[model samples]
Target: SRPPSEEGHSVDELCPNVRIHEGVNVSNIMEVPFVVSIQRRISPNLFAHFCGGALIRPHWVISAKHCFQQQRSIDSYRIVGGTIDSEDTKAESSEIADILYPDEQSGSHDIALLRLKSPLTIAQREDFQQLKLASDVAANKYHSCHCFAAGWGVDSLDSGQPMRYLKRARLSMKFPKKCYEEHLYHTGNFPLYEDPSLYHCFERGEGEDRGVTMEGDSGSPVYCHVTDGTGRVDAVLYGPVSFGYYPEDANGVTIMADKMTYTSNPQIHADWIRKNMKQ
Candidate 1:
């Protein structure tokens, strides 16, 4: 079903509803190997959708469980990585065998495992790399460091169209307490505050340089810069983008969006994430 702005709708719509708002366009694949685009093939002549994901292992991806709320068949998804371009046929696209959910009802556990139907074809190509999941201690280590997020999200606030071009944005981490106060999303079975295992992140640059997560950016990973065991600076997955706030204009239409603190809280669910990494 299309919004009032749209003309009409089709019974089995092939379009996807999903972004990185105020993000820089990226072309070099090596710069962000861990980023992945989740797509759905609707019909024979239909367009494949562009969603967000992260490559965490040879045969697995980590994404927000709500991404699958559409509940399309697992086989309908095509996981694209290596290159940011969605139409680039040369890029590595793999099969989605199954989607594992920690809690079927969704509740507090919003993260999910995207088990690939086949292992990734990394070989000599350095463009496809496995991302490291961050522990709570590891997340704290990069408290003041620069963090990042990438996606093929929405182009602007006025459209449901995908950016097509891969984009990344620098984000500032928000404290859990402050995030709770800001969003006040903690409610009923999905109370975000009572569960420390669930947290939030937001882009807090001042002035005209603000950014936010959009419709298509769900399940995208929050990356933090952390020093590896050998003291080398490395990037690790902080969590998956869960939800955000959408502010409206005076006319009751959406303006620029905000409030991105809600996430899967990777630090708090490390044990569950590890146990279900490859399965």
Candidate 2:
């Protein structure tokens, strides 16, 4: 049972429910109730929590397809929710029962869905609320708008290690060309960055609040608020965080300070998503 709230909650254009270990933490569990941690159960005593995801339905989740590239099987993965901190093991959890995605055409399609072993009674959980899948209209409406991403990625610009707390970062939709020019690892015409079906959401953190997604953030939801003409803003899921990079400028040198994040276009896969759900 997923209950979606208004587009932009007044307290914040919120991000994945996060708690920052350092700097200003912009997100919390209540703000982003749909966020979840996807983990891999390597053995009886060991586990590797690798990525972030959004709960779209009680039993359905949205995440980056590439997250499963090394996925062994349904039994090897798990989903944890109802908390902002991944280090906390007391959160509600479930085993991933199944996973599905489209064949890749050179990274054009990076979105995937997971089936939880059991339904998440979202209505019963105070800290867990599912996000509504944005319509094509909603997606277009929030274009370049203030969006947020939450996950357990790197803690600092220089750190590659995963943070213990969920982190929220501000971002906006970027055009394909701008994405290529500003966010790619290089200036060359990369097909994935040029693909219209994907959205390049960029975050160059300013001041004390640095907003960026890192290595472990793949499959995290990239979302925003969709305001109806009447000013009612409903939180909508835009896409799943796909990749992040620092692009080069005309000087042929990479800009280490600027971070570019890409998300799979949920609007582009709406039809397939609906059809796949019934199977």
Candidate 3:
């Protein structure tokens, strides 16, 4: 009975309200090697939506860019490379071979790249791990990385159900004019803080249980892990799950969600992935 924006959230801004109970699950974690999960069948009466990709080589694949600008091309997709259990994936087949978004409408340069027709059998290679794209990041501050988000969202959001197995979350890293001064100035809509290309931000729960990005994880891949002398994958590919900044409500308490969750900046497509990835 505390919903009026959780009584104006002051419990240190809030971010871990719990409330999962049970029903839809997806957290095998495999002990973090290299996460990848991008499912989209788009047929047989819909129902196959999940986004979250990264595996920078062995035929490339990096996502976001509104996860493919509403499809209509790229053969309508079907890629499900390694890990993130669709059933213990030893390679369950989803062999897509081409897809690239980002013509303009630059919401900080979304992001999308996928090419895999063949090349991916180094015998599984310990479940894949190949990401290295940080073009000397610098714009604002705050960097404490460790991002790995496998999708099939909804472990709790009141449980809409659809979390089969492939869920991992541990995010923290905020910058981008402090995410446009805390949640894009309550979303006045567009023009989020003078377009600082290659966007970045990741903070969790700060006003009635927050810390967002769910629902198939919208082209996920906001990574980290760079030990200076060649450690690899420091930044690139962001935004997916944009919504939050609940000032507050009232009555019989119906919070449902709070704020702080934004990603969408894959290095402004890095020149559209060097003019269409294939390297």
Candidate 4:
């Protein structure tokens, strides 16, 4: 059963036909070498999954700012990488040394960077890869790009439990106008930022094989495949999963609607990210 909503609607009344299932798991760790699991310390010897992030550098990680809003202490968080399975005991782990956020006075961006206590050995590691931020030009062309999002978030809304392994889903970028209009119509409010350019809108690809992010998936990286200078197939970091809007069906069951997932555009904060990563 799903949890009760804030409006005092019982789970049965809110999601009477709720469906639960596991997401499509990544078969190989190398497929998403840049993905990392952000975890919070729950006990002296145990930590629990919290959010998702991407390794942008050997010692730097990019994630959503809201993931740390309730817990600002650096010592309370750590990241695990080099494996797709969240519960892999042999996965590489590191303590978070510090967290950096862009100046709020400039604008509201859901992105943030995490500096690791020590640099992870990315070179010659088959399971580790650092992602590069997408340029403004590339980001502007997302409407025709091939993109996908990967994370260890909950497989379904009703489960409320994070997946034991990473999952990847194909997504199609939505035009800004349609994205904004549909979101406003369903949610009854504008997006977090007034500027549509500050975020990238995506919808799950059609079919039964499609996947969507659920609880605990915030900060997951959305990468778009592109050809680099050398003509080799590569990927660039477009943004991080900021939020999603799930609307109710005729039966009051919450449904993962199209054009719901919103990702914070990294191009808008590329300067801030590069500047902070240097320090």
Candidate 5:
């Protein structure tokens, strides 16, 4: 059994206090070809899901740096893809060869890349593909777009464990300024960082159109569709789920309203990514 959080809830329940409420189960692996389950080897033949990631290349994956907080051997981590079910032992996996981070750390960006020991045959697999990073232009226009995010994150506070199968939610992007303002208004303070440009914020829709990022979702990619002048639609990676604000009431209890989640901007680090991928 997994350990419990300080609040007596399972440790996987609500780290940072967010979740993909009303998210729908992913029916097909092809729908999220770039999604991968980042796992930690708990034993010789057993591995446990630690976080979510996206395949950027056959041999490279992008995930949140915070997921690897405590120092651990690189050999202890691996990436599994081509399946909607995170616990599917039959899904193909690759041992991690190396981990890379940006050279200049601003103490804000929560992104990292993992190189696979061997490149998977992504071209040959119908259910595996690489996700393209959002261009600077597309990244700027993300606030007007509706995006989709998928992960095996826990669904609710009542359910302290992550969903066995993959699930996805359609989310509406919010301006970073608005997100920061709302956070300050409700929580009486700013988030970890005051600079809004360092993060992309999102809010869940109303009624049937609601979902939010939750615990165990760190590093899961959020993608949006961009139509070029030629009328071709492209799904580009915006960022990965990093953190969120949980506003507290007068009594200091968390309130559910305005559950805003944030992701680190990949476009800002694109140059760093390109430079490091070559090495």
Candidate 6:
């Protein structure tokens, strides 16, 4: 749902939820592949919400487990592949056969695998390519990698409604141990401290011109730099968003999902997808 404002402006026009006007890093946006939009439209009511996701295999989608924890039926969820456009983008939409999540519910190991009824069709664009997944990203190799996250989430934290055009930002990778230290968690199910297994951390420049992750951005992909060999995406899904710190300071910051920490290993989830989607 969009946020309300006293001035009566459309949700996308308000601050924090402001629209991504033309001429804002559109070039880099094309370089990312495997980005997805998670959409759901319940019957009787036509309203919808968009979250980010990534395509691991042609039929398997890696996203946050929490994204579908509330969904009653798989029919309600739709995976939109192949475009970051906010308003009108045609994608290889697929019905979700099943959603796989962890039974223990650890944030650090928070991940979900969506099995599509069918594989996706590739688009011809050179910039659009499949993404890889890394088993381990060494702490020493923190290459200041440039990455991006796209969604219809609010531009700022306070004003709400959804944005019109899909928006993206440049992010730098963070070490898992460093993330643990910065988030202040010393093992054992810390909600505030992201689990290092299923998530990775990234920040904007100086935290001054900080890029934000807000409502509706959940389950979205936080992709690494295009230049990276293998172009492997940081998999794990949604981690700590602005609210994890302070509610009032909306759009305060977000910590991404750690892919290796594993509440449930992605490999197991991948195996489930392969076995289940075929059935």
TM-score quality measure for candidate 3: 0.31
Clashes of 6: 21
Which portions of model 6 miss their true places by more than 4 Å?
1-30, 44-47, 86-90, 102-108, 123-127, 136-144, 185-198, 206-210, 226-279
> In model 2, how large is the Cα lDDT of residue 118?
86
Residue-level error in angstroms, candidate 2, position 18? 17
Against the true structure, what is each candidate's TM-score?
0.77, 0.78, 0.31, 0.82, 0.81, 0.63
Looking at model 1, the pairs that clash are 18-215, 18-216, 19-153, 19-216, 19-217, 200-261
Residues 141-205, candidate 2, lDDT per residue (tens digit)? Answer: 44223467888887765677677777777665565667665544444445554565567566664
Compared to the true structure, candidate 4 yields what TM-score? 0.82
- Local error of candidate 4 at 239, Å? 0.8
Question: Across residues 1-279, which tens digit of lDDT does each residue of candidate 5 receive?
Answer: 444434455422322222324547788777778888998889998988879998887888889989988798988888998889888978889999888877545657788888898875652575454566766445432222337778998888668777889988777787778877876775668466667777888877444545777888889998765543233445678788898766677898876545677888888888888777798
Error of 6 at 230 (Å): 13
In model 4, what are the clashing residue pairs, if there are any?
none
lDDT to native, each model: 0.66, 0.70, 0.52, 0.75, 0.75, 0.52
Identify the candidate with maximal TM-score.
Answer: 4
lDDT of 2: 0.70
lDDT of 2 at 107: 53
Q: Which parts of model 3 have CA positions greater than 4 angstroms off?
A: 1-51, 54-58, 63-85, 92-150, 157-162, 165-247, 250-254, 257-261, 275-278
Looking at model 4, residue 205 earns an lDDT score of 59
**Which pairs, if any, clash in model 2?**
6-233, 6-234, 6-235, 7-233, 7-234, 7-235, 16-150, 64-219
* Candidate 5 local lDDT, residue 6: 40
